[model samples]
Target: MSANSKVVDINKNREELITFTEEEVETIKRTVASDANTDELKMFLHVAKSYGLDPFNKEIFFWKVKGKPTIMTSRDGYLKIADRHPQYDGLVSDVVRKNDSFKRKSDGIEHEYGTERGDIVGAYALVYRKDRSYPVYVFAPFEEYRADTKVWYKYPSAMILKVAESMALKRSFSVSGLVSREEMDVQQLEEDKESPTKRFKKQKEKEDYIDVKDNAQDDSLSQREKEIKRIVGKSPKLKNDLLNYLEHAKKENDIGEEEKMSINKLDDQQFTQLKSILQTFKRLA
Candidate 1:
């Protein structure tokens, strides 16, 4: 999102016509440059488009995970996508407790929410169509677990039902381009604003592979690192000249610490900036 741009929350049942504009996204590019990478921003856009959500209208959202953007939608967004398809008589949902399922009959309008009963897991949905013999079954589980707190950060009941609902909708109507909002980031949307410490606290809490020193034992790479590799993989011409570009960037930025540094070794911010710059070069090439 841009400094001037804002996202508005809407009802779960409401339908919206979203159109992403160049200006709005360009602003995102500028804003992300300071903290996030171009690929992260680009992935947000791609996921939004592929899933048919619009950030401009707040149908979906961008979350800052470890100072990088991750795509996610609010409970409202999850619900909105769920109700898009037509329902059949076979439509049924249930509340899950431990390993047992409590069958709940639906009136086709009212949904039965899950419970906090013994080891309350999540809700289940069975979406059916006119032609299909078997109803499309979907399991929507809670994704708000916080390892640090050893608890689920999001409301259990809120997530349980919506997870089931969204799952049913996506599996039943996936061709219409629906994406699951589960496991996506929603910290910013949940709050109007948070303190910087609180904002980055989530990042610190999450265990990510970061290589700051020239010699490190951890060879595992983060999602951002993988994204850089994918971006580089797109352009053979640019990939061949990556070393030269890296050298120029280091010289221009006044960095002479290490003559040799792999692209994966660059920190998140540096990698993001480099990817953006290389993308421009890729386009030209």
Candidate 2:
């Protein structure tokens, strides 16, 4: 066959191998890639199919920051990719506390801690490959990855360990085009008022990977509504700011009266829309 014919055949074969049904594709677009445009959705599906990821199972997800698409995978998703590699062996990881006896020897890391290990300071992950003599090791400091988010606040050690493990797995397996949840700092993204593409470009300059927001869409509709309401409820300043912004937008005829309803009275879809409007308002402010 000619070179062009061979390329066409490979593309056809790949398309035939995709297992996501049309319904699933619609669901993915509506929920996971809700903010994605057509070109963004195409790129997302290409990466998903290339990695044999199941969006239905959330092995990978789509997020957008300021209109720029960001693809994210879990640590388990990275491990899943590694497991499919023939050279994969196993993995070991741990978080180091302030009192832990941690040392970096020639072969691998030595970490020891007791019940009273105090506060977590850092974490390390080691990925063993059957073809390699030594394991791929990565260390992540707590301060580097920790954020002022609910997840980080509640599960600091687990989150940092995930960061270390994701780094190690990507290094060992050459995984590309995916960022784990542990690497993202949504608060930082919000606080940085740069253009969406510019903010991501700056992050890429530093980390060479896309950044994702929180795992908010993973929750159910009712759960998301409650979470959104809870977030607005806790921040008196945020609530006041949102109300004022909505009132201003109303005066400009940008939004309607329904958008000004109390957060508790809004339904699921309205809550999501309200949250999105609030984000846009914050960005503009």
Candidate 3:
């Protein structure tokens, strides 16, 4: 198939593919010139080959790992090294407990956060285009490990290709510009203003008021009427009816026949629909 045909097929499967912008490419070139190391250069070659770009593309830039190297030979070696280094011992213990699937070394170096073990020490690099210039980050892990001897071998080019393909899949959809440090600080400040407990308490208070209102409208015979009124004021339906009934009952000096009948009818309805409401008031009393 033609190159265009292959590109079409790839695009069909991965719809988010984006080419680098010119400015991004130039920045990458500068970074590569200033800081590219052997490992980063290797990763770049791996990424380029997987993307069907020339492995020696002039525009590509690579970033190298920095800081003190932590080396591990075997599980015992890792532990030994960690025990000697206070800062790294905790990390080693955490990895041993959490990463049961991996073979660890005793004495070499502590693994940094975001590092994954393949067969050897895993490392990361960024790939940028010379033409357009967006960064595509790549992670390469050791391909083979000897548990007893504490040796790791470089992952093969084919394995590296797979890793590169995975990185491409991720980069294709990723946003280029990231939130600045200042923006992140502002976001954290806003979040700190409202804690989870405070938000929950506010929601619960609103719900309690609603419950009190609903109960008042449905219960007239409730002995805890005073308490309910205090909770959510008098219900509109019950307020007028209750006032009129009280007034009439007081004027008659004794229960009138019509009033007695109306009271009885209301009692019967309450026994059926508002039984639970009455029970709640009784409990409160």
Q: Which candidate is the best by TM-score?
A: 2
Q: Pick the candidate with the highest lDDT.
A: 2
lDDT of candidate 1 at residue 28, scale 0 to 100: 55
Which 10-residue window in model 3 sums to the lowest lDDT? 144-153
* Model 2 TM-score relative to the real fold: 0.65
Return the candidate ranking by lDDT, descending: 2, 1, 3
User: What's every prediction's RMSD, in angstroms?
Assistant: 15.0, 10.6, 28.2
lDDT of each: 0.49, 0.64, 0.31
Cα-based TM-score, every candidate = 0.42, 0.65, 0.15
Candidate 3: deviation at residue 75, Å?
A: 33
What does the lDDT read for residue 262 in candidate 3? Answer: 28
User: Candidate 2: what lDDT?
Assistant: 0.64
Candidate 2 lDDT, tens digit per residue, 1-285?
A: 123322212133454324455555676666667657877877787777767777766577776544457787878888888887889999999989988899987578888777887888888999999999999989898876675544567678887888899899999988788887665553453465567798567644422221111223535435544555555543333443445433333433444433443334444554565575444322211
Model 2, runs deviating above 4 Å? 1-18, 186-227, 230-285
Looking at candidate 1, what is the lDDT of residue 285? 22
Candidate 1: deviation at residue 254, Å?
12
